[model samples]
Target chain A: MIERDVIVKGDAGVHARPAMMLVKEAMKYPCQVMLIKDDVEADCKSIMSVLGLAIVSGSRLIIRADGEGDAQAVNSIVSMIEHNFKPHEESAEKN
Target chain B: MANNRVQLKDFLGDTGIIDLQIRLVAGSTGITREIHVGDINRPGLTLAGFYDFFAYDRIQIFGLGETAYLHQLSEPEKKEVLEKFFSYDVLCCIFTHNEEPDSLFMEYADAKGVPIFITKKDTTKFTSSLVYLLNEAFAPSVTLHGTFVDVYGIGVLLMGKSGVGKSECALELVERGHRFIADDVVILKRIDESILMGSGAPMLKHHMEIRGLGIINVKDIFGIRSVRDRKRVELVVILEEWEQGKEYDRLGLEDQTHAILDIDVPSIMVPVRPGRNIPIIVETAALNQRLKKQGIFTARELDRNIRESLKRENKEE
Candidate 1:
């Protein structure tokens, strides 16, 4: 299993929307993904299981992905959470 | 695409349809026909032998004028026009103001497997309402992780990392007498170019799942006035865990915006800490937005005052 530490930077801590976003991002890979916050571990594939953990901002999560393409899956998930789960960057506003 | 098809069954029991007073006049068996276009066509010109620019795939709306004109036509002429009209693949026909078409027209529609819907609303009302419903139904939408609340007449959307107390802050606002729109999952729809409407997702409506506490319904626990069905999003407040030595916008001079879909919304980042009263900060932020809308900028005013005082002191020196 490939593992990486990710910090939740989303202005809003990982809640229902971010949890669903993480779950969806995890589902794109053909591997087993898990997020561990403190001692609690959550399966990234199940929306309910991930949301149940209630991991918040600044919280460090050790993501473990096993099976084929585990490295790629772990990298993408790490970026997804670190990037505040934004699908795209918001162009800075010129005041 | 305009050719994208939606079933009539999907639109039947929608909240907007209830006001439409819609009923199945004929062809209930053909309820599965695809509703191709979000736009509606009156089809009066098409009925009058003008087929060059006919949008037959659109939902056909027959008003009093169109119905009256059809009645004016001779039986054979009407039959010929309708037969030709039904020949092309169209979504369905909607008759407004409970206006019943000629019985012969119904037979043609039934035979052609065209669904017909009758509404008590007049042509103008039905057209406006239907257009709104269709646009909203097919609008590009996204579900966001945030709590929507109305603070001092301003819609404040609270967003942050998971387990960052977003819901807790929203609950605090709810207890402070502000109307709560949605907790956990906020479904946002771009109703127009500039307007975005925020509503609670159906599964977790009126509910907040706190870490220590399992689940709490704000509407039931608080009162009806404490919660709302939806609100027009005006300001976005993002809560983040406070980091030592990290620079934050203390002066609030630079305007920040968060883009969802193609629309840009005003946003502010509030760092969360043990002693910080986030709900109060959110309230003040919303109030500040209300003031901004009214052409008042407190920070700019303060800056101006500081400049004037500094200039006076320089002259004195």
Candidate 2:
């Protein structure tokens, strides 16, 4: 497994739309994915789970993946987060 | 490593800790000692025994019944038991049935810096809860990156450069019958040599934020089953914006890998393009990665076939 800590840079944080997007991305792998906040843990691929957290921008998150392609998965997720999840944006806006 | 501190509520239940006391026992060092009332053959003993043997970092004792008799025991008996307790490397004493330890025992415990806990629940329930807690607390764990999604019996992690729609893709995947692990950031720690465990940060616990929608709680929206604290990271899919001039791998002939700590993991780069179904692509990528792990590499197989054909032509020439 590989894990990385990332800051939620997007303006709204991980809200409904992005939560759904993240869940969709997580559904692609064959490994188990988990998101933890403090003592609370949630599934990374569920929109409801993402919503349950009510994560806001500037919150620190631990993006973690394990199994075969864990490193790549972690890297991709971290990159996407670093880029602020805006696939269409030319450059990520710093929050 | 220091043992993780458990919250008092977990051990003592919902009731607030009305009273807490620590005392140093004069004699014991390593041996475990316990005082409890009632039959020695109760069901609670089974659990108590487990704690005696497993729960503590050092010694453990299960004491039943009245504290008065124990305190009144003959000096020889007390010395013998205390000596035995002290002989070991660590010692712990448990008083069951809410039986308070004598003032002397409390003083001893305090002086020794030993942790003492008193619970109002029956021994059976307490023991059972303790067993459950111990197991959970000691379970092996690991940490990794990439949100873990369970889709069609596969664990997929959608990767990409920042703003490349990893979260969006994950949301879509969830709608398509997949589970969610985490978004934006994940925490991974190694609990054992082989296992890598993953989790989310405290503030981001059950939340995900999109570019436009703002923050959302995953647990509330998805229910208890939708969220998980940890999972093994399996596959990685890198999402990168499509560059018209840049050459992207059209075939799977070349292998790309990324390293986490000492482990080298397989990686796939998926270019982001309009009208592309990212979740589907990521799902396929996970499937492909699984197949490759099983030694079935489509790219390698094709390369071998091409090489074989070329060799056959050369022989004919």
Candidate 3:
């Protein structure tokens, strides 16, 4: 398994929108993905489980992925988090 | 560090006791007197009374009833109690109760350099929990000759002399879908009365240095699920080099156990030889241990089968 420490940078943190985006990205791979904070472990694909963590901005978390496609899954999730989950920041601002 | 000694002045007010000597106050004016409360002759005395009799290193005050009752004693009675409290070899006092102690008691405690703490739990609940915690915290532990490995779906601790293939066996176990808990130096912590947990040191976490392969990161190479932070040690597998003259237990008849922190854990000794499948044997050993825990003993069953066969031969004769 590959594990990396990630800090939430999105303005809304891991709220409903970001959580849904994360879950959708997690579902693309066939590996077991988990986000851990302190002693609590949450499945990355479960929206309820991720939301229950109340992961706010500046909170640090450990992202772990196991099985096939683990590397791709870790890289994709980290990229999404780093990019602030903003696919069309320019277009949204104009609207 | 010597100054760290909790003085009564910290707990009680500065002028709670005039002379500051440990002496019981008796009579109307609180005449100071020295009394031994631990003695049977002086029964019904408070915790302070018992401390006077026995020079205990520490005093654990289990607050059963009202804490205010302690202050209800007359001035002389209170002085007598304080004298016992100061004279005893008490290091610290723990009070268990949701209620607060009397202000005068606090003053005396601070003046006498006694350390006092209050917990929200009741006396009975506090005593039970404290005893449990202390037993585990103070249990004896020792470093053993072993390499703990995460076998296929099991935690197998490999033990043997230096160069007895312990590390080699662990390397193979990791390649076979099992994770690695700790290699070489495994630090064990006593979690509870009956449990001992094992974890790798910070420098060695997720990094295993094999003799032939050098250093390798298990997490980076295998992935996250292939490594664990800690694991509850379940079985101890000792690997001994094969000796021609030595007798080996081929039938697992005798029961073996390894004692760790006063708890007996199931143990197995496997003979190592050229071309032998050590990893597979170790995996079987783990599975066998799990089955044994479920009350199914394979060794005992084999022994029973042999006995039945012997009985049949005798009847035929």
Candidate 4:
């Protein structure tokens, strides 16, 4: 299992669009991913569960993943938030 | 499960389920204070200065008896008792039977940040309702992604991966005259040690999202009889894609259970395929669950009869 804490830095926080992105990213890995905000833990793969956490700017979030490639899965998601959920770098490089 | 303390504001303003018929009389600033326990304390003994084992944490109920006693006390005595009463950090105070608290008590409560409320309901009626509502509010709850329906008077929760036809199955069941409780997100609350009640999220109740049809309101499309606000979760039906080689339960001899919030709920898995009619199967599962509840096991009874007949035939031979 791997865990990393990241603060939501995006000005809009994690609304529906960001929550969808988070779920999309978490579903790519086979590992079980969870987002812990306050004391509530939400399944990262489920959009409803992630949105229900009501994450806001400056909110502390702990991304925890278990199973194969758990470390890379956690880091990928942590970096997404740390970068303010920017578009994929490859797509940005295309422009 | 963790107990969620009921906020004083929610308790006072809630008019739907448990109506305490209470109105704020004093200490408006303290309305935000939380009521930790569901039980109420009469505080008759504490008023007489016997403060030993005083349950100061609960909401103090000043009934007719306590109100009359306070009215009879002299100025200095009343002041002394009121001071001691407010010193313990009482959650709140309620005067039942439309009784009013004296100025001294109100002053003490307001200064101490302890809210004071008065109810037209008598002591017995008001306390009973308050305790019941508080316990329900404090009950532990969890949310899941599924559709809950009442088929043949049994609560059937349909769960599966998104787009696996849970919502479609529930819609078909509703069309067949079953009641739809919730779709998409189901909020389940443990009412007691044995019973788990399931309801729809407040915002998403009576709504269904089909794969191609988008979102549709079940209640608006169907009549009121087709929708229920809540029901006890009696059975769980898990719908998954049909795997060619995976062994399925053919005999119904083994009891399968899924745990939610540490409680085991009876569950069954139903594979989905193009030719299979999932709604009818779910409806049958619900009826079977009802029979089991009534102490009738059809599969076991049939197996027992067959075994007895085979043994008798062997003996005769």
Candidate 5:
């Protein structure tokens, strides 16, 4: 099993777009990926589960994976979170 | 997709649900054609030469009214409407109340290869039965090895391998004033693509076979309120034998699903062993599912509250 802790940096945090992008990225891997915010855990590949986490900005998220492709899936998710879910977003409003 | 098509002969003769002893009068060869629609139309307006909005895909019903209308029309006018109507690929026409079509109409039906059927049931009675049969016949379904029960108005399907005590748990739930839908085998049908409805096998309706207790009628023993004909499946509870050294969901914060017939349903796995109150757990889970439907997730809510408090503490520091 592989795990990493990263902080959400955007103002809106993991709402629809970021949650969907994370789910989409996680689905490409053949591993069971999960996101844990505080005590709440969510399946990384499920949009509903990720959205249910409601992990707002500055919240520490633990991305964990266990399976054949756990390392690759976990690395990508952690990297995405550390970058503030930025590449997919349309510029920053600097709030 | 079962919605594609079906044969006319099979629709009447094969389906035991319709219960109409209908006989074909004409267009016998068309029995092998397709029945694309899951509905039956009375063809009231279509008979009056208004083919603008004619539902040719549906099973057209020509009852006493249509039969009488044919008789009133002159031979040429009648033939024109029949020819115009039959020009389309009509699935099949049924005459209810034992009202057989006239010889002229039969000749036209035979020529067009559009099969005509006769049923003795009244229009109202036969229509309802036909609608139900068509709905059942076309509904996409799959048989599952599970026991279905209604706990607090939520359909909870208990799924597990053999000798897993699913029936015993269901029996306990029934004893706790819950309704029994099916035991041992559940036929789950997709109402649309999203909604799943489950019912027991006909021969085993309301009957559950326990390991040592043999077969028992849930309805007979528990009364009418204790058994239901069918219920909309909302949640699935999988009972597996308790396996030590395996990690289980302790927090209940993450959501899980069980896939059945391409639809993913919210599911939970409960490790079964001695001294565990499986029925109460199932009841609580069902109640939680209802609350979730009402836009409330208790665990998630608690997490949010805790996170906000911790943030406030950090701010104060």
Candidate 6:
């Protein structure tokens, strides 16, 4: 299992669109991922649970992942939040 | 999480479903005000000039007692009390017993953009109904990838991987005189600590996707008898692809449960193969679960009988 904390940088926080992006990003990896805010953990792959967290700007979130590629899953999710939920250049170019 | 708040307009719009029987009397523009709590307050003390521990965030209900108290106050006193009452941001105010608020209260409500509503129902009845409505709206809910069905009056939630035949099994169950609640995306709401209500997404209700047959409406094809809007999830059946050498349960001796939203529901694992009649198996599971609910454990009873007979034979020997 791997755990990392990342603060939301977007002014609007993690709203519906960002929540969807986070779920999409989490679906890329095979590991089970969870987003924890204020001790309440939500399944990262489930959009409803992620949205229910209601993460706000400047809120510290703990990204916990378990199973294969756990570290990569945590790293990618942290980077996604750090970048304000923008698509990565490499992936943007591929698209 | 902030989006968990239900707007005042939402409750008004859902009057048909919940039978609230409420109508806007003042502050129509404030209909969009959000309701943060599922509870309500009488505000009788607030009207009596007692503001300590005032629950202003909750929906305020003015029963006959409060309304009569307001009616007895002089004009100046009423204005003074109303000003102080509206000073704090009250989500909304409701008048039960079909009582109408005076012009001063309506003016204050309009000025503050606090929606005011009146219902013909009495205080206790209306309060209970509104609380029930708000509780349901604010309940913790999660969307799961599964199919929900009612088999022999038991709610059986079918879950597994994407291609694990959960939908097909539910479809067969529906054909066999059962009721289908949801398909693919099941929205589960924790009604209380122990009860979980399962329903389908608004747009995808009663619709199922078979491997090759495409999307079909279960309600339309199977008729109304085979469809239900929601049901209490009493059992969960997980269907998985049959592995080459996996050992399946031969006797139902041990009880199993699957947790959803922190509530543990009785669950069973069924391995699916081409020849297995999954629908009949699910039906039998539902019946067996009903039996368990009635405290009739068939397997345990048989084991107990065998032990008793063995004891008698050893004593005779």
Top candidate (TM-score): 4
DockQ (Cα-based) for each candidate = 0.04, 0.04, 0.01, 0.22, 0.01, 0.08
Scored by CA lDDT, what does every candidate get?
A: 0.82, 0.60, 0.65, 0.86, 0.83, 0.87
Q: Write the per-residue lDDT of candidate 3 for residues B147-202, one digit (tens) a residue.
A: 78877556777887656887778778878878887765565656666687776655
After superposition, the stretches of candidate 1 with alpha carbons farther than 4 Å from their true spots are: A1-95, B1-6, B13-18, B312-317
| TM-score between model 5 and native | 0.59
Question: Residue B198: error of model 4 in Å?
Answer: 2.0
TM-score of every prediction relative to native: 0.76, 0.51, 0.53, 0.85, 0.59, 0.78
Candidate 4 ranges beyond 4 A from true positions: A88-95, B1-3, B161-163, B183-185, B201-227, B243-247, B253-256, B262-264, B300-317
Candidate 3 CAPRI classification by DockQ = incorrect
Q: What is the TM-score of chain B alone in each candidate?
A: 0.92, 0.60, 0.65, 0.90, 0.74, 0.95
List model 5 lDDT by residue over B71-183, tens digit each. Answer: 89998898788788878878789999899888887887888788889988888888888877777668887766689999999999999875688889999999999999988
- lDDT of candidate 2 over A1-95, digit per residue (tens): 88888888868888767877777777777665666655456677655556666678998888888887778777777777777787745554433
lDDT of 5 at B58: 87
Candidate 4 chain B: 10-residue stretch with minimal lDDT: B1-10
True contacts kept of 4: 0.04
Q: Is candidate 5 or candidate 6 better by TM-score?
A: 6
Can you write out model 6's per-residue Cα lDDT over B1-317, one digit (the tens) per residue?
Answer: 21375788888745545878899989888888787778889999999999999999999999999999999999999999999999999889999999999999999999998999999999999888888777778888877778899999999999997668887898889888999998866888887899988887675667777767756889899999999998999999999999988988888899899999999999999999899999999999999999999999999999999999999999999
Per-model TM-score of chain A alone?
Answer: 0.88, 0.85, 0.88, 0.90, 0.88, 0.90
- Cα lDDT tens digits, model 4, B1-317, are 32375688897765467778899988888898887776779999999989998999898999999999999999998998898888788888999999989877888888988889999999998888987787677778887888899999999999998778898899999999999998767888887787888987665568776766756789999989999998999899999999999999999988899887667889999999998999999989999999999988888999999999999999999
Ranking by lDDT: 6, 4, 5, 1, 3, 2
Ten residues in a row with the worst lDDT in model 1 chain B? B1-10
Candidate 6 backbone collisions, by pair = A54-B1
Q: Is the docking of candidate 2 incorrect, acceptable, medium or high quality?
A: incorrect
**What is candidate 4's lDDT per residue for A1-95, written digit by digit as tens?**
99999999858889878987898899899898989887667779766567667799999999999998899889999988877788668546755
Query: Model 2 chain A: which ten-residue window has the lowest total lDDT?
Result: A86-95
RMSD score of candidate 3 (Å): 16.8
